[model samples]
Target: MEEISKHTIHEQDIVEMILSIGKKFERIVLRGAYEDILALFKKLKKKEQSPQHYYQEQYDQYQPSAPPIPPDSAELFDYYCSFEVHDCYEQVDFEGKGLVDNVYVPLLEKVCNIHPSLLECQRKRTYKYSGWAFNALGRVSHFLETTKLEEMNVDACECLQMLWDEVQVFGFELSWLAPQVEFALNMEKFMREVEKLEEEKKTIFMRIQELRMKFKEELYFLYI
Candidate 1:
């Protein structure tokens, strides 16, 4: 095996790092290869930090559970292609497609099945932070339907809608204020609809009040 250089931070360096730290940090191996080497470097530093500062120490205090590995969809597709009847993944020149299917899929399914609560939290909307919940929900929803999700005990089945709603809210406000080149078209259309609706609502309210006042005057006149 060719030894990866210390300064080079390519995918190969990550593979080397994982293999080097495997015995001490089997958990790190579960992360997707798509994660950058720099990110892995930060994670490795965190792992080495004192038990008091991090949960890994506390987690290891008790018998720690195995890290959950998500199935690599790319890998699974490649495996399917290899069946001779189909060769769909041949066109895409991507690495790690095989490992995703072989290693990550079963691990992710098991983790999701066991910890639907954790998954549900991730599925919640907090766009200011990580969008893992929405991303995870999209992936899961691609595989399973809302009816099937009922079996999993998820409280918020509308995670995707919520994510979209939040994005629209943020995008609408930002677009209206900044109207950047990318958002100009959508922003103008959205604002026009919003303004029309507001004007229509105000008109309806005024009409209702006018009718009420007319009825009141008519009643007072009849009494006099």
Candidate 2:
């Protein structure tokens, strides 16, 4: 009886560790995927602007005054395909697709390849374990009503053992996924920092341009 209790405690510890690792892995994968999609959008922004230089020249000559409409998903996909770096992923069809299907899932798969199964486990495990817990509680309740203490103990121990085994399997999977998860997370952080620096550079250049224009205006006024 004492040995059974010790084993149950050990299993509980493993379960907690598995849950913590699984949650962390899920969060990192999702966050990294989101950042990757944002990076693609940034690339699309640069591509969309490439044509604008020509438009600006034409506008200076003709004074055309059409406001730009934002690109829809299809347009974004087209621009995404135009990038040489993303040529490998261009064949991925995005027709009538949601963000998760087109962007997050694809990026996650590119990084780790185990994303689908990991996502399934992350989403389903809670509900799966909750159902098992409820069923086990009901059985324990019935056993108590019948005054069957030994049976109740056995049933509870079985539930614990099942949970322990599931946790072990999940932990093993996460162990292999850990390196990829860390890489994705670090890549996301690097992308964000690069974007921030680019924005700052743009801001500084605009300020310098504004100062130059102001200096020209002052010189013109002085000459007048």
Candidate 3:
């Protein structure tokens, strides 16, 4: 159909499908689409119609559409959760200073025993008892701290934010993961900003290259 219509006639239809696809959220899993969906949701929130203006007609109502979850819910389902922390630890040595067994495991066991109705608590928090999980969290952190923002995994940062959100309301001060969560959320804005800057960097570099050429030279290096 795209070949026949040249992707023009179905453009609005495609947009509508994207807007209505609440259940099929994996379609917007990438950070770029995730941000766009957020921007639209924010626009709807900001320009909400007055109560008087909204139901003025006979049985007619003007309702702005909304997404299934809020903008930040993207990484709430941590994709990294499936990878086993135990497996990561089998080949290496990582001591928890007696914190893993006496503290982490006991807390996790208690949470699992909770009635599922309470908080819908899925006790899947990573305690970094494994060397890999520890380093993986730091992998993106390393990128964020340095100039290589593009290398950082936005999903990891977002998962940290979601975890922090849960921990805040967990009724106690679990100081264990607090600092790591702070570090993750503090630099979350760079996920979008660095992407924007990369695109702008490309445009500027392309223009500069074009100007550097006498309308005829071609040189290729890194674009962004």
Instruction: Quantify all predictions' global Cα lDDT against the true fold.
Output: 0.33, 0.33, 0.34
> 1-224, model 3: which lDDT tens digit per residue?
22523544232233344446545444333324434544554554544443223322421221111001111322433354321112111122223311222212322333323422212321243333232232332222222233222333555456445444543443432343344344345444545654555565565445434333411111121111
RMSD, one per candidate, in order? 32.9, 33.3, 22.0
lDDT of 2: 0.33
Cα lDDT over the full model 3: 0.34
lDDT (tens digit, per residue) of candidate 1 on 1-224: 22322344443344455446545443343334313433544554444443223322332322101111133343543343331111222221112111122222443455445544434543333532223222232233232222221222222223322323333432122222122212222333444544565665565445445434443343354346
Q: Could you arrange the candidates by TM-score from highest to lowest?
A: 3, 2, 1
Write the candidate numbers in order of decreasing lDDT.
3, 1, 2
Give the alpha carbon lDDT tens digit for every residue of 1-224 in model 2. Answer: 23423543332232233234454334232334334433544554554342224333533322101001112332443353331111122222221111221222233333233333433444444544422322222222222223222232333334333323333443223344333223322333444555676675565445545444443343354346
Looking at candidate 3, what is the lDDT of residue 157? 54
| Clashing residue pairs in candidate 2 (N, C-alpha, C atoms within 3 angstroms) | none
Stretches off by above 4 angstroms in model 1 are 1-93, 96-191
| Clash totals for all candidate models | 7, 0, 0
Best by TM-score: 3
